[model samples]
Target: MDVRSDTALRLPASDVSPWVGLIGLATLLSYILFARSFPEISAALGFENDLGRLSGPYSALLAMVLTGGAMAAWSVCVEKVHRNPSTGIDWDRRRPVADVLNDSITKLAGLWATWFIIAGLYCLGRWYWDGAYLFAMQVMGAAVVPLVLLSVPYVIWIDRVMDDPRDQSWHFGAMLIGRENFDVELVKKHWRAWIIKGFFSAFMISILPSGFAAVVDSDVTEIVRDPVRLGVLLFELLFVIDVQIGTVGYLLTFRPLDAHIRSGNPFLAGWLAALVCYPPLAWGVLGNILQYEVNTADWAYWLADYPALLWLWAGWLVFLTAIYAWATVAFGIRFSNLTYRGVLTNGPYRFTRHPAYVAKNLFWWGSVLPFLVTNGSMVDMIRNTAFLALVSGIYYWRARTEEAHLLLEDEKYREYWDWMQENGAITSRIARLLDRMNPRKGMSGAVQPAE
Candidate 1:
């Protein structure tokens, strides 16, 4: 099993099996038709409806339907592009919209079936452990376990079935040290001359006031009295500190001996849109364009009309920031954009493919509530919606470009990309949309291979 052998390196033959699409379609149809029976199904399983007004009987059903549709769309896209190894006419050929839509519907059925089994298992768990704490734990486990079971086996199957018989040694652990060639001269040169240095300088200057304000506004005595408050404060501090460390590390530390830099997206729209996200640049460009700053209002003010949800809003804020910092910690010193330090499959990375981007975007949407801030004017509503959409779209572009870069850098990344497509529990709507936009394209906005 010589992994480097040319004969073994090529992709395997396509599995254009009709049964796959048929099974998926059947599963999707079942869910959509039986959605009304979800409440009865839950009750029969001994699971109580505790979400109350926040989530009605139809809520779970609707969520499941939407999830099924998204999963189906993603599955079909991956199959159309990556699953078929035959790279000639079929590679460039575009299937008719009707055929694509049918395939997607079929995948939705497969996804729905998977969720159905998971829900049944969740019900079984509830029957066993009826306590609130245990029920909550079981609910979380149920959400994740099915996906892991389905996806992990798929990854292993792909590896075993691949023509190359991918070397186990090429996994994430091997990526940590890389090809050990520690060039001291190169490290010094990079530190002395890099655009990242200017970014670090600007970042520090920008974060200063917010960092200071976190400390200044907190009441030490009050924090000490309440454990929950103390925990929240500590999370905020850790978030701030981790972000700074990540910024510094991006420029000053964690040098890879053997590095591969991917070509940047040439599109002005992608880079320019992404640039306005950071400070100094944001202050210069976005500050002028935006009439009101999003962060000026509290989460509760924008989210819930009642003051009762303040604590809930605060909790969400803490959760969001913690996840962001968790991602930074996972990356260690390899957190730069448009570059591959190495493949990271541990920590938060293990949970989802792009936890940082997803979490950051989630936080922004939750905190900003752009549509909620109408301010008694149609124009304001439109403006806020447009602004947030632009910001979100930029991040989406960032994710796409980064994926393109990684896909070109190494075969290992291609393997990872495939695994994520099959098994990753979370899906990015933006990523899916981009793929839909050009299903036949290898990587949108052409990129140069790593030198």
Candidate 2:
């Protein structure tokens, strides 16, 4: 097959069917409904429950389980993802347990060592013990024993049927034990994937409880009358959806669902771009050094006098936030910052390559109104706008590094890249604008994204 042919290259069918995301979304919505009505139901049943709302952090954790389990079941039963070639499993070719027993033992050794290193890093990072991360640390501490005990059986069983059981974990083990020749690159890939999972998983889990609780306990009586209040409530709800769905993506990287991390971004630039946008580093750099919202009055402040404009602007911001959440939902159980589970060509992706980034940056600009300062200092206004532009530029750089990683990782991503250049609605227009500016980009033969 000529993969580069126009007929073959045009928008390939989505690797992840949209139905996977829908099932998860449906499960999440139902959970939210039940959480909101729990108090009323408890009272009707003459129960003595006194919490008044299902706002516990554990309830939020349960939301992740429900959403993740539903999506995994759908992937295994409906999509038959377990049968996919990428899983590296051949159910019909099971080997004698004794044949792969040594390999499984070595692999388990590497897996245990990797977990220990990750746990050490978690303890070393001070942020993990502070603020929202405390819950995450508690959860990890509780899972330590269970994860260790379950790894033995799971590793042994999977190794017996795997087409070739010497995977990345095996290579790492071989490197450590000096039992046989091990590829240097495979060991690096193994560590890279685990490091990404460790770092982002903590951040994602740390954020889940607060947003989940907010959505469940939101008081909408007063919000129903005020446009600003209603808008903020909606923002909280949408962000909870995004965080819940995205957290599931991080937690459920199981082979049966074909959602394992194929690779993590290898470039240092990718790491810097992503890390600086999150906590600790972001707290110092973007929040303090380049603080763009120093004297800014947000959308509510500016539009307070104009009631009609206030309502319209609030609605506009809500729309952008919805797009941000929708982008995460489109990933189904495959969403993560620096990994590729599959090529997504449906939903908001069919229009723009980076809908989440674009919407997120726009949301910041609209909500903060950074250019319109309260003190009316021209220097402050210019500084605010310029810093915000720099923030957006960072997202652009992140997008580039991601495209470069995926371009080299899979041909499907390359095909999607080419297809978007020709047929994507927003992507095609952006590509044209860039071409008009460079006029030499086509001759380069390098795949660059409009993101």
Per TM-score, the best of the predicted structures is 2
Candidate 1 lDDT over 1-451, as tens digits, reads 1123342333322222323223333443344334434456667889885532222222322332343343334334544423434211222444444434432333333334444554465455432244322433343455566655664433333333334221221222122234343344433333222333333333432343343245334656777644446656756564544544354334322111111122233344545555666654776655667534443354554544644565566677678777776776555333455445556655665456678877887877776666655346666767777876766677777777667766765566676665555345564344455556754544444222345
TM-score list, all predictions: 0.47, 0.95
Q: How many clashing pairs in candidate 2?
A: 0
Could you give candidate 2's per-residue lDDT for residues 1-451 as a string of tens digits?
Answer: 1125775447877878888888988999899888889989898999987887778889889888899899899989989988999887888888888999999999998999999999999889998999999999999899989999998989988998788789889999988899787888989989988988888889888998988888888888867879898999899989988998898898888776789888888999999999899887999879987799988989999999999999999999999999999999999999999887889999999888899998999999999988899998999999999999999999999999999999999888888888898788899899878776874455455444466
**lDDT (CA) for every model shown?**
0.47, 0.88
Backbone clash numbers for all candidates listed: 5, 0
How does residue 366 of candidate 1 score in lDDT? 74
Q: Which stretch of 10 consecutive residues in model 2 shows the poorest summed lDDT? A: 439-448
The whole-model C-alpha lDDT of candidate 2 against the native structure comes to 0.88
